[model samples]
Target: MNKLIKKKIKMKKLFSLLWLLCVCLTMYAQATKLTVDCQNPGWLSNKITYGDQMTVKDLTVTGYINDTDIKFLCALIRDRALSGGRLNLENTHIVGSISILDDCMSNGWNCLNGDGHLASLYLPKSLKKISSAIGNISVDSLYFSPQKIHAVSSESFYGGDNKKYLKHLFLGENIDSIPKYSFIDCENLTSIHLGKKMHYIGEAAFYASTNLKHLNWNEFTSSLDYIGPKAFLNTQWKPDTILIGDKIENFDVSSFKYKDGCHVFLGKKVQQISNASQWWSSGIQNIFLHSKSIVPPHISIRYDELHYFTAYIPHGSLNAYKSDDHWGKMNLIEDITHVDSIRIFPTNIVLGHLGETASLSAKVYPEDASIKEVEWMSTKNDVCIITSKGTITATGYGECSVIAKSKDGGLQAICRVAVKESRPLTAITLDIHSLQLEKGEQRQLKAILTPENPDDSNVIWSRSNDNIEVSNTGIVKAKNEGKVWVYAKSTDGAIGDSCKVEVITHVKGLHIEPASLTFKKLGDSFKLRAVLDPANATDTTITWSCATTDVCNVLEDGTVTAVGEGLAVILAYSNDGHYPSTCIVKVDTSTDINIQTIDYPKETQIYNIEGKQLTKLQKGVNIVRIRKGQVRKVIIR
Candidate 1:
């Protein structure tokens, strides 16, 4: 019985051991199960070295991660092989670039022989930055579309002929600088877009990138310093153009290289050019030096199609300008146009002050080989001032002609002038002995001007504070309140005229007749009628209005029409001939006519009519007058 019991215990122990082994094997297999999620595990605690050979295809990783996880994840990819045998990172992202650096350098990454498949990468928005430790990768195109990225490190992408396979590289907005040698040997790169917020670019950042055709540098940077010598040498291209910031002061040699033709634009602030001659000898055809005060060393101008010269040389350096040997050999030079002449005239100048303002003129010319900009300068204060186009304005008292000379060499001209002073008529007046009138009376303003200059043309009349307007026909109207000052302005620059009158605002009554009327979009001629209060309608004018002048238009005489829509505000003003009274008239677009009797009689008649009319008709029978779309009546006794 004791032996049998011991046997049973041993059997149970063996069974338990077998069960444990099965569980261990199951757990190992579960962990090793490969899928798209684990393809780019970004935050593993351990990293696989470049020695690891792995490959995978079509991975999707979306989330926050740390550096260690990314390193190991990359190693795992290098150790595996994908279907049809090509390593692929379809879509992936990491908080750093170290893992990618190790994976790219694995087993002498060679895309040329197709041994390792490291070609394209897509970074999502979750990545915060790309690490500087990124060393080598055979990937041809790298796309980084994250919300932010810190930098692209030096030597991050290095390879040989396969380097040309990297045709496109996208940097995100958060990248502030491009580290030196980041894309040092990317010979196949055709376009590189630096982020807008980037302020610093390290030396040789794109050295030996021969295939790079277009580079769009940051626009707002103020201190962008590093661009190395021959940095973009031996690139295959057409006669492409290059543009640098207007504020940059220092530049490197051959920062921009082209195949057929090239040009360099020195910043406006660059005051001098010391070295950098080899770049000029390459494909560069033009050198635009935009400096207010600087001259670069002699340039070798060999290209035949280059003829445009633009430079801002200093004003006094005419003798220092000499064309280069090659530039002097050109057979044809474009003709230079002469600058405009100066002119001066008197505005409100007292006739006795002709010496202060006399007509003057001068001509300017293009500068010599130096290409200095020409400007007009005045040496004497209040004596005169000259504009670039040579328009002179007199300040004080004197006669002087404007002077002009080339900024570099050649070209000059001047205009002749004469000055004279004679006493001119300053004021004109009407000597009224006295206005003959009883109490409570008014009169229109009338006057003549004494010749101060006898040439001024704008003359206007006023009463107390209001204007008593007069016409070119000498017809005057008392348009406002109080005493009147009939002043005349001269448009031809002559003496003005003035007169005075006392106004009585408290008139018994005043009215401008024809309170309402209609017209076409053009106009209708009608007599301006005025009626005084207390049955004394006399010495009055009917002024018209459309209220808003910019809109509909109306004449000074009472004639109006519909210009736009809604309602047109017409005003009828009685000037007393002293002070005027105003009345508002509402004009409706609808047509109106009146058929009434002048006397009690009878007959039937019709006639087309125009102009002012007065008639009376019998109550039953009458002759109706009809004009353009309107009807009226005439009565017969």
Candidate 2:
């Protein structure tokens, strides 16, 4: 009798469980759905009563909504609860920055008195600057993107940790920008739908959002401008494809994070890609670069015997990319545009003077050909040299062929160049016969030659006395109050012209002669002249000093004597202002300056006194260097 009674009690409990499940299913089937225009004064107040909150499972608020309209809905929610349902405030056109929770708890009503958690809630499509109360409201998902939102407020998706329940978010239409740190450390965020209207993503906008993954960027970010550094750093993003717009010309490191095997489309205007050697882009097995550059844009990537990935570039650029220093490491394929052929303007080019230069121009078969970048090279560089832009430099008295090659199709065009020895210089004329300058002022004197096209355009500048200073380039500086004769003498012969320079002011500066010197043996000595401006100066005297006394020494009379091997700077101080004029002297351990008519190796390099490297020797002083360890100074008079 006891066993039978226990069995009856167990059966009764099982029947009660079945009844509770049926009631839940029946309530959902009978839940009320409401749609109303928020522009109506009593849109919510007329349709929803205080006790009807739980009954309304779906609520669609359309048209413009203000602060008062939101209060009406809160008044009803403060009395009831809800299940996994939706409440969509389509586009709040009237105003932006409205808060839902703030209206419900207004007038000191406790937040605890409001409804239970909501499953999904879309704030507004036209509302910008997500407020704290709206962002903090109890909702499982927060959906908001604006067609009119152009500014970023700190109280956005990154307001506070109170949005732990917020999960999936979606943005659509014209959103301007995502400011820096907008969604930092939002570990609960799962997926985001980026709209088509965003201009840029600020630095570290979504940084450290570890759990945030699966971003649904639109087919094309047409208005995208820039993506800041580390914008998506530490985010769990593993999208299948990434589409970059044309407006962005640069990408900062750590700006985006994606897994391996993702397809990337770079707009045609992109000129550079940094960190392509790093894991960020190395994992990407395929990339489509639409740059219209004939010469491939530089790519930073890991180079090995095997290619890391495949690169699809504009047509006709296959030959260019295949030989590139960076892009060649990857498998390159052509896409669309190509160049057919190239032709040189002139079949032969002739340069008369040694220093003369000429440009070789060309035109593609099709006038509208895109790949027009051509490179120029000379077959015999010893005769004449050519710059990358097709400018030919006549180095010696000989003949050579310059070839212009198109980077895209690798088509060639050749032009022969002939450099002849210049005719003898018969005479030299000055631009001005006489000129007067201030104490510290300087002037450039021009030298006109008999034969305008001379192989050696070289002139040596010299002054008659200590009244002024002149340079090798024919520049004159007034030193004394008296007149001075400035002469431009040709290196070929004694043919030259002279100009009279007169000072017309008080002494203001000092001038130095023999600016530099090379000492061959120990105890070599030379006197340096330091002339003060305006010869009428009360004190024209100067004192001499040597910075490196161990290497060389200077006498009070301005005499520089080389005692050791090295460089020494000799300075002469002016009596009035203590300003110093300097001369640099270098001593060689063992040097011979009398070598005449000797052949030189092809590896020999030459430089001017000004430290400018020369492809061929020029007039005045030349430094012939066999290597960095060996050097010889040669002077041509």
Candidate 3:
């Protein structure tokens, strides 16, 4: 019984050992799923293997990774180690050729064979070039953003047995050229996006891409310079619509071979067609040319190729095309025309007076139409006469119709012209009612007439005195110092208006009387006078102001009054802006001073500071003055 227990214990120890071994193996398998970061240069030489429970599941390459590292990765793919893996090299600066060998059997691994699963590549703008043999790898999807790639090499996508697996191709901007056989034999390529910067499509670039349904050649702008022969041969992309942009200037022969039943819109800048033997041959229906495009001399579509095709030319250029050497041979060329109409300008006209002339114009619809000239005639010549060139002249006082008829069709438009009689002279008035002038001064006056009339309302200007001379057009000249009356009278009737003019010599300087004055207390007033140098200066208007209004104040007529016990300056400025004068007024607060009544008459009235009449004067100050006369100051202490 003890021997039997020892056997059972040994068996239990064996079972525990096996359990620990299994757990270690599981941990080893889990740890073998590695991620090789190509950003670390150390990993570039590291051989990543698969199929022995050691798998490199993911590889990340940052922009710092160079082409050598990419080449190493491609070599690993060729050696069948990184098969069925994911390569994320987005925004990496990997450039140069990407070569993948077609002889997968040389690797001695089934993963590199025809049924081998290649790594999915995510490429972005940093990559510049893709090697021609990259298509040898059996990749299901290729995310390519070749914005920095200027040209794609020939046979760049020349996949051997794996050509049928490429599903999507994304071409980025800045790729201008696609060499011959770039995407040759990519039979399973279903979708492709071409960038706008592409200008040249080489021979057989997309040949035998059977699953591709449509190719948007319309994105090719004027930068599209050339298209090689058989560029799209045998492709399933028989697009129903093909729009060529305004920048494309040339198209080679057989460029769009096997493309049929499409409506092609040609751009304005397409000036040359090298050969048109096989373009739009099968089932083209319509071809619309830009309004400014001129067909080249070498471009000619055979009758059999375009039997049902119609060429739509510019509105006014159809005849030119039909008369040309090559374009004239096009049997279905037609002009784009619109419905015709007519319009007359200045819909309403008013003649100022009899015998006055005015001009009228007409515009025809479809400005470039064959018949753009119009015939102008007056409906009533007795009222107003109109020339054939649309010039109208008033004959008598009435209304008439100026009719414009299109020469091509019977469409006509009319403008109504009214000829009214001139208004009779009612009254005449000058722009200014009164005028004051200095010697050698001149002024231009305008005359306003009541019941304004453009004709028959002439005014005659005259002067009553010779001191100032009036011109025929109401210009007044001040010759000597005196007053005169300038009159503007209507010629028809003697009705008129006159302006009183005062002309005097110019003032050289200003003189202030009593240049200095003294005031004993507040409420003291003084009358100041400003005299022109010549004494007869017409500009006697003066403006007065006190330097300090808190101490003294002045009126518009040079009347100064002391308000407080302080000295102040009273200034007088002439209306002509020159010859300024000032008066110095001194005030004393030492004594109880009384206002002087000498400057005022006995009939002068007495009032408070607020200009209210008072039966008795206040104890401080009073304003005593006559109505419309000088003011007097008084202090009642």
Candidate 4:
């Protein structure tokens, strides 16, 4: 009986051990296949391991899901799981906040451990809103439909402790604004494609995102109105070009700050820069202005900012900007006017009768070009004469070609001019009523004839006095100091007009001011003014002569330019016989020293030649007042 009882006890112990082993195997299998399907009601409430800590290979919540299902899944992944291989919520009506960070923090999970083995996350297309703070999570990529999402709240992708694992972020269409600090410190985020409806970017939205490189600004919507201050501050991604959208209205200070050189192309309607100081601090080196953009007067930049910045304006707007109070202060404003082609209006024209005229006009390429000056020429002078002002006059019954050439670039447009017939000449009129010229001065005069006839409208020019001579083409030349009357008569001798011409004598004496000048460096120029004895003398022509061309050169207008460090004498002689004036120029060579390195004694005092105490060495010739009253000249290039 004792042996049988012992056998029963051994059997009972073995049965108990087998039962415990079966339970352990079942729990292990459950951990590996952690998945929840909310297709059926009360599916989450029916699960026994809903919020228990377990190692999960995959956690998927799919089919007919709601906010409660999403929150429960996030809680499971946040509190219960040791390692989540994947978390997918597909084809579910997920609405409301999905705060994974909050769930992890509330459950006392090791959020800083960065061991959440979540490699991928996919929110269902039915997700209508995401008003949660999903930051500091390690995920390789994130994709969600932004169709119903309005904005990315602050700290949405803030990588708090773990290094951001997000490589690409696809925010689908319909996202509007990105709140402040949304992606702050997301160091590993490389690329992001903004939604088509994204309009406003809040302050510091992308601050300290050092590794984020590329953002497709072209995908930005037309309704984008403002970019808040410091929106892109301290970003590592240096875009090559920043193209502002046409509908953008304002750019706040440091909105698109960058570290590398970039070119900014302003939109056509971007009329205001809220604070130009922000642009001054940005790394943009070139700016291309729109044709109609009006640079605001409130924009102010420092000298250092202008040193590396260049503004390119329309071809003809250079002078207009140069004359502006604010824009004129910019040193490197250039014209980018380029002509690709030209079109002449009225490709073919016909003048019905002699004395009948028609005006020709051309449309130049890049219509905003500043220089629209066209040179008009007639191919066949016997048929018609085209004035420089683009007026075609029928001379006789014939055909001719009129060409309009651009003065800026030599692009030409041609027009076929045909003279059908000629009418009787009634009156001849000169373009200029009267003319006054000094001796040796010459000018071309224009004449027009009226009252049509089939005859040549070319006029015959004559001068009444020998002092002034008129050419056959109506060019007047002043031969002597006297008054004369120049006449332009029609070929038929029916009617004519006269122009009074006056000539003045040459200057008798010339005096050059500042007889001597000194230059401290090469490439310096000084202007020499000539004073005539008679203040009203007409002949102010003077010749400039340099004693040594190797040392210095004098221009025709009496501008002495120093070529090297040497002494030179510049002579100014009056063309009308007067005592010549001399100017001695001495260019100092000591100022041309090239400084390789500087070594100064400790506590040495330095100053400039103007006796101002120097705290630091300046560019160019720096007169150093050294220790013990000893002076030295140092040139810093």
Best by TM-score: 4
Global lDDT of each candidate:
0.46, 0.69, 0.67, 0.68
Candidate 3 per-residue lDDT, tens place, 296-389, comes to 3346545444334456666456767777665665554555444299888889998868999888999888765655778888989888988888
TM-score, candidate 4, is 0.44
Regions of model 2 farther than 4 Å from truth: 1-31, 36-47, 62-79, 91-116, 125-129, 133-135, 145-147, 151-154, 276-292, 300-309, 322-324, 329-637
Put down candidate 4 lDDT per residue, 1-637, tens digits, no spaces: 9999999999999999999999888776666555566655335545536323366656666555433454455555566663445666544543323443212222222122223445666656554434332444566666666445577642333334443666667776767878877777777778777877887888778877778787887668465766777677777666667767777666543676654456666666666555433443654555443334644323444544544445666544577777765566665355556676788888999888888889888888777666767788899988889877778888888888999888878999999988885366778878888777877899999887676443567788998879987889989988897788999987666679988888886566777889898888788898999888777776677888997887889999999888887788999888766559888998876655444456667776667668787777777667776678887777665
What are the models' TM-scores? 0.37, 0.41, 0.43, 0.44
Write the residue-wise lDDT of candidate 2 on 527-619 in tens digits.
988878766665677988887988899898888888998888888888766777889999985533444555678889889999999877666
Question: Once model 4 is optimally superposed onto the true structure by TM-score, how far is the C-alpha of residue 125 displaced, in angstroms?
Answer: 4.3
If ranked by TM-score, best first, what sequence of candidates would result?
A: 4, 3, 2, 1
TM-score of 1: 0.37
Off by over 4 Å in 4: 1-63, 67-92, 95-122, 133-137, 154-167, 218-223, 246-253, 259-261, 270-297, 301-308, 316-329, 343-362, 370-405, 413-637
lDDT of 1 by residue, 10-129 (tens): 999999999999987755444222224334444332232222223234443444343555444454445454222322232444333543432222222311123333455554444443
Q: For all the candidates, what are their Cα RMSDs to the real structure?
A: 24.7, 36.9, 18.3, 39.1
Worst 10 residues of 2 by lDDT: 102-111
Q: In angstroms, give how far residue 592 of model 1 lies from its true place.
A: 58
Model 4's lDDT to the true fold? 0.68
Model 3: clashing residue pairs? 222-247, 222-248, 261-283
